[model samples]
Target: MTILQPFSKLLKTIEPLWKIHFEPRVPAEELAKSRTAGSIPSFGFFFLLTLASIIATLGLITNSSAVIIGAMIVAPLMNPILSLSFATATGNWALFLRSGLTIVLGSFLAMGVAFLVTVLSPWDVVGSELLSRTRPTMLDLGIAIAAGAAGAFSLTRMSIASSIAGVAIAVALVPPLCVVGIGLAGGSAMTGVFGNFYVTNLDVAGGASLLFLANLIGITISACLVFVLQSYGSLRKALKSLALGLLVALMLSRPLGTSLHEFAVDNRVQLELHGLHRDGRFRDVNLIHRVDTKLVNGVAYVNIFGAANEEFIEDQKNIDNLDQRIFNAIQPMGVHTMHIAIRIAPIEIFEYRNTSSSYSYQP
Candidate 1:
């Protein structure tokens, strides 16, 4: 106890910086009312969550990012999560359980709505937006933590609460759950390629659920920390929930780390390909048409497509030598096991003829 005196005094001195405008910004009574309102089991909450789920599901199905962002804005899911953090901070058991139950029920309700909509719709294709949420990285966790802190701080300042819409955009609480439903609706395996730790044989729904779980835990933990700093509750009271959140984050770290590493490898491979394009060795093939790289189960799969003049595409030896050079280039970058497939197709350069206004190919 005697050893902790200096630290205790130090914390008291720096509490203002941590609070970010401090208490009495919103009175205790009004704050309690806000939290209670969030925790209430109301028809409005369900309506908003269900509607948001439907919109997000359709948005993901159509690969529309704007629609998904709109869904994020309309989601009521953030309020209950914020309330959960507040309950944990204050050691309010009834409020904690009530908020938790609301979150769980809301998640399932969203999923149910998504599943029903997916089943009714004929277009079951998995779009890029849907695939993105199926993979979560440390970057996503970082965003959720920052957004949670911003959200909690906003809640205490009535004037700033309206800006919480931006927090909804940052945290992304609803889309993942809706993705889970879409995955389940298809009943097929959804594979995500990362480094050696790629996920296969798992359905999309299961993969998306992992992302949702990560976001939920990240937001809850960060919100609790912010509330504690604001003098809303004792750190001791929120320990168990915080511990659980940290444990989940720790468990998620392995896959998230693998994804980050894979992303780096992907970028490096693209840069090397760009260097090859700039070297002018391709005989008038000045542009790289497409480069696709996927790392799966310790192997990198590279598909390179280029457009060139007919003469350039006709050289069999050049194609073979170029393939060997690409293989050699990536090898120096620590990519030992990779398969590079190159496809060169003729690009017809068109010019309008003045005589007949007809288009003719040049070279």
Candidate 2:
């Protein structure tokens, strides 16, 4: 009894501040009702989801970020996801089941729609925007978590409700799933060759599906935390759900961490290669057309395509020296073994003197 007195007094002191600041502006019951209604599968919901999926698929095919953003704004997928998070927080078994089913149904519907669109379209192009979603890193998890928190917080305050669109765009719930369908429909077995190294054909659908799963798990966990913090649900009740989410997130982090490492290494290699181009040794190089870096079995393989003066292009010794310099530049970055391939196109200049005032042509 004596030990409990201090804790009781501390709670009394903190209760007012908690209610004033941390408590949600909207009533918990009201918010739950709203989310429950939104989670129901209706014509409107499927219609918007279908349109959003088609738009997203087309945007990905065309490599238009702006169009993709528009699809994100129009997507109705976020609501069901938020509903699921709310269900987890409040321990509403009925809402939980409903939201889960809705999410699954909506996901497949969007994928089907995207697949159909991709199949019917005349253009069979896979753009960078689409491929970018295939390799998700821990960085994507962080974004999903942050977006989930922001989305939950905004829902509790009506004034900031409009920001949910931005949250949708940030997390990108539909685009990745659409990419899955697009990958299944039009994706081909493609190989990336860098110098002597090459990557096997990638499973585009599998990678994009993993990205969607990551986003789903990340958003659910973070939103549940936000809901509990805002007093919309009890932490004790949400513990089991949160625990399961954490378990999945932990499993996901392993692959995501590996991907993050690869991305960092690739970026480092690209920067080093770019630095080589700016150095005095490559002064004759006019412009770098492209630089591609790939890591295979702990070895870095770099491919460089650039335009250089005729003199530099013809000099075998200078080219060999440049290759050696590239190896030296990237060696310190923990890359013990590397292969480099350089393709330089000569930049030829032709000058014609117009000595005659009037032009005359004889055929």
Candidate 3:
């Protein structure tokens, strides 16, 4: 009667011979205990990782999907992660530690090399492509969880391991981290390093990078649950742990995330207000969500396209004042930490003119 069992039943009906197991190789609570004991990578592992990083960097630069997929396949970043999940579920702390380290080291190394390559690559700075990888969401976390489960299932069942790996690679693990590092190397060092760019007096931050980490945690937890569900046969215990973990995350994520965001925005505002604070052109403010998470020239930019008016423009005295005010508004939310480009333009409202005034000039 479990929520997932129905889907399992459906799969069995569709393909009676499908080797779906109700229990996984390990239980859930143990997965939480998994850790990475520092271990050196085998020569082969590093070699593949290096190559994959190179290819992924090229793909990022070219903004090519094909190339990116290719790199994902070669990267093989998900195995150790999957192994870590297994180790976690099984209460094998030593294996879990080893696997965790493998994932961290592999992911970081790939990203670092990718950062250098991207910095030197001949490519236009495509913020969207970069931005896409930066922010993760609830949905993304769902994908990670499912992917982890499927991956564990496939590997343990001796099923289509290759296909599962392919799927997991495509889903992502290394590329986003690589992009975060590359964002810094590609002249976004200031914001990228701290993870935000604020140029104007007002802006916000903490949009995407945190989301990426959220997704990672989601996937890890989901995989842990799946491992327990499919392998341990102790559904009661696994459910208990899974429920507790999720409750904790749910309780902690929003406030913690919001506080972090505010801190970032405040930092950005402080930076801008340091030099220019007198006649800044800004006043009452509301943050536009779209351009709130991007960086250019080592500063966060907020888009005031919809908020600008002649008051901030015509009043020369409001330049520094406006900047300060605007900064104050969003600084608490990191509106300046990301892509908070504030453009000064008159608010244009289309007025429907009555034809009666024109009097048919052209007969």
Best by TM-score: 2
**Candidate 3 versus the native: TM-score?**
0.56
Query: Quick one: best lDDT, which candidate?
Result: 2
Per-residue lDDT, model 2, residue 324, is 79
lDDT of 3 by residue, 186-217 (tens): 55332211113333221112333455465556
Off by over 4 Å in 2: 1-24, 189-202, 284-297, 301-334, 339-363
Alpha-carbon local distance difference test for all models: 0.80, 0.83, 0.57
Q: Residue 67 in candidate 3 has what lDDT?
A: 79
TM value for model 2: 0.81
Error of 3 at 207 (Å): 5.9
CA lDDT, candidate 3, residue 112? 84
List the candidate numbers ranked by TM-score, top first.
Answer: 2, 1, 3
TM-score of predicted structure 1: 0.78
Which tens-of-lDDT digit does each residue in 1-363 have in candidate 2?
Answer: 698999999999999888876534988878998899978988899999999998998898788999999999999999999999999999997888999999999999989998898788886555668778988889999999999999998999977889999999999889999988877886674333333333435566887887998999999999989998988888888889899999999999987876776677667656665676678776777676556556666687776777778998888988788777777766776678888888777787667988878887999
Regions of candidate 3 where Cα sits further than 4 Å from its true position: 1-40, 122-124, 187-212, 233-252, 255-363
Q: In candidate 1, where is summed lDDT lowest over 10 consecutive residues?
A: 191-200
